[model samples]
Target: MLIDTHSHIYTEDFSEDIADVIQRAYENEVRKIVLPNIDSSSVKKMLNLTEQYPQICYPLMGLHPTSVTEDYEDELQLVEFWLQKQKFYGIGEIGIDLYWDKTFIKEQTDAFRRQIRLAVKYDLPIVVHFRESFDEVITVLKEEMQPGLTGVFHSFSGTLEQAQQVVELGFMLGVNGVVTFKNSGMDKVIEKVDPSHIILETDSPYLTPVPFRGKRNESSYLVYVAQKVAELHQISVHELARLSSNNAERLFRI
Candidate 1:
């Protein structure tokens, strides 16, 4: 079995053929897929997908970093309200992202720290999405570091030192299709990190792995990623599936 720790299948990108998409995932041995909420707008679809596949899909509650605006506090209240209403498996897709716009960097930092506290309070793992703001994200993570604080750095593409810091801080580095990109150089970083401190993710409908790099990525394509990581560790794909799936189950409690 394999687990896709991060994916946004609920987005309109899959609305017309979600059933087919999900079926393909199962056919490819992807037994579980966690759908992290993007914001208030996506909550309904995200929750609906979980309802549709309660056995295979799970949900996370949070306002994505890109959605952080001047009205972020109000937006965060929405996340809090949902958290109070239901049991989510994680608290993320949360963190800093300056790739598009840096105008809300300050707001993103505040929101990231606040959500980390919420994860601490609820005893849930955080699924972080750090982009061009790795240092910024690490700073808040360090400040909010606590005994019960733990999570995955989704789509992590940092240096070996940063990966080590995250593992040491009790978080797993979420590896995805980015690792398969011929030029990403992520394999070099993964080579030095313990496989136990890593988890599989696709971030699908986005970072499609090679052999299909320019296409719309799906959960099914995670097999290619699993194969790549397994090769990097000199292990079999079956072993990668077993170990990474176990790591995900332990972290997400699903």
Candidate 2:
């Protein structure tokens, strides 16, 4: 069995065929999928999907970095409200993203820090998303580092040095479809890292693996990523699946 540590299939992108998507993922041996919230507006939708697929889908509550706006404080309240009201596998789909916009850098940073504290308080792992702001994210994590605080860097496409740094921080690197891209250079970086410091994800509805590049990604495609990473690590796909799924299970307690 495999666990897709990060995915957004609850979104409207998969609305038309979500059942089929889950079926395909299960059929492909991709059993558990972690669903991270985008913002306050997404909480209901995400939770509803979890209710429907209680066995296959796990929910995470948080406001994504890109969703950090002037009114983000309100969003955080909603996140906290849900956290107190229910059981969540983790605090996630959270972190700093500078690739899309930089106008709310300060707000984004503050939100990231606050959410990290929430994760600590809740005793749950965090699913981080860092794009063009690795240094900033790492700085905050270093500041907040404490016993029992850990998570994965979702969609990690960084250097071996960076990968080592993340592992040293007690966090796993989330490898996705990007590893299969010929020029992404992720395969080379992953080659040097041990499987113990890695977990598999698809970031579905985006970053579709090769052979299906340019098409909408789904949990089923995680098999493609597993196959490629297994080849890179010189291991069988079954072993890779076991290792990555075990890492995810420990991190999210799912």
Candidate 3:
């Protein structure tokens, strides 16, 4: 069985053929998918998707870093409200993102920290989104790292040192289609990290794998990522799938 740890199938991009997309995923051996909420606007859609496919789709509630802004406090409140009323699997798609716009940097940090505290309070794993702010994210995690403060660094694109730091902090590095890109340095770093500390994801409708690069990605394409990891470790695709899927199941308690 395969588990796509991060995917935004709720995005309008798949609204026209969501059932077909999901069917493709199952046909390709993807047994479970975890949908991470972006913000207040996406919460309802995410919940509805989970309701439609409860056995296969699990929902996570949290404020995405990029969604943080001057009015972030209100958004955080909304996240908290939903989290309190539901049994979400985790608290995430949260972290710091300075790639798109750094105007709300401070607000993003505050919101990330607040959400981290919430994860601790609720005893849930965090799915982090770090972009051009690895140092800052590591610093926060270092200060907050403790028993029960574990999570995955989603779409990890950092150095071996950074990956080591994250592992040291009790977090898994979320490997995705980026690992299949020829230009991505993930190949080198992933060679050093243990597969036990890694999880597979497609981040579908976003980072499609090679041969399908620049096109719409989907959960079914996760096999390409599995193939790449197998080649890197000189193992078979089945072994990579088993190890990676096991890692995801352990981390997410699926």
Across 1-254, the per-residue lDDT of candidate 1 in tens digits comes to 99999999999999999999999999999999999999889999999999999999999999899999988999999999999999899999899999999999999999999999999999999998888888888889998898988999999899999998898899999999989999999999997787899999999899999889999999999999999999999999999999999999999999
Which lDDT tens digits does candidate 2 get at residues 153-238?
99998888999999999999999999999899998899999999999999998999998999999999999999999999999999
Descending-lDDT candidate ranking: 2, 1, 3
For candidate 2, what is the lDDT? 0.94
Q: Which regions of candidate 2 fall more than 4 Å away from where they truly are?
A: none
> Of the pair 2 and 3, which is ahead by lDDT?
2
Per-residue lDDT of model 3, residues 142-243, tens digit only: 877768789999999999999998898889999999999898988988988888898889998899999799999999898888888888888888888899
Query: For model 2, what is the alpha-carbon lDDT of residue 4?
Result: 92
Model 2, residue pairs in steric clash: none
Residue pairs whose backbone atoms clash in candidate 3: none
lDDT against true structure, model 1: 0.93
The most accurate candidate by lDDT is 2
